[model samples]
Target: MNHALAQAVRLAPVVEKVHGAHHPELTRVRELTQALADTTDDARIDGYYAELRAVTDNYTVPEDACEGFTSHYRALQESEQFWQNR
Candidate 1:
């Protein structure tokens, strides 16, 4: 796995703790990241990447977001960059 995806995987539990496991954004992040990681097909990768991009909203950090959330956001952004560059 790539560094960004690895970082996200590491941070996921912490982010869930801070944001709550059921948080929509976190759930989407987990779902999309996992899907991206699990897929090898080019079309599926692109599709998942697009969904992840839309969900992350350029990884804009919310004003009231906690450190965990911000960190996850950065990781997700890096993951996005990794996919885009690939």
Candidate 2:
């Protein structure tokens, strides 16, 4: 998750540069990414997951998910493992 957050921080500006600052999805990603990057506390991380759940309904991947969707969920699951060990 920390790595993902760092990547988000690194990529958001590039995304905005190409997609424009007003692009809503990228903007939201930036906000969430920044929030995650700003902390290492377990409680705070849990809170971020709460917020993410509110946004993504527990990261529900549909049955008909595309490759990207599957990869995203897989990454999140790995992130959870990483966080647990940290």
Candidate 3:
């Protein structure tokens, strides 16, 4: 995996804890990150990118969110940029 993806993976659990497992935002992030991490197929990768574009809108930090949550979103955004540039 690339560095941004790896960083997002490493930060995911902490973000989940901060945002709570049941949060919709966390669910999408976890699923997308895991899917990308687990797949090498081109079709699946294309699909993942489509979904990721939609999901990126949710990666913003809410006014009331914690520092860890903000960091998590930053990592995710970086990961998205990495993939988009590839």
Best by lDDT: 1
TM-score of 1: 0.78
Clashing residue pairs found in predicted model 1 = none
TM-score of each: 0.78, 0.50, 0.75
Off by over 4 Å in 2: 1-30
* Residue-level lDDT tens digits of model 1 in 1-86: 78988787778767766776445676777777777778778889778777767776767776767887888778878876787788
lDDT by residue (65-85, candidate 2, tens digit) is 455544554544455556667
List runs of model 1 lying over 4 Å from the truth: 21-23
Q: Give the whole-model CA lDDT for all candidates, comma-separated.
A: 0.76, 0.56, 0.73
Best-first order by TM-score: 1, 3, 2
Task: Report how far residue 50 has shifted in candidate 3, in Å.
Answer: 3.0
Best by TM-score: 1
Q: Compared with the true structure, what per-residue lDDT tens digits does model 3 show for residues 1-86? A: 88877877877777767676445567677777788888988688678757866775646576766877777778777776777688
Give the total clashing residue pairs for model 1. 0
Sequence-dependent TM-score of model 3: 0.75
Clashes of 2: 0
Global CA lDDT computed for model 3 = 0.73
**Candidate 2 all-Cα RMSD:** 4.9
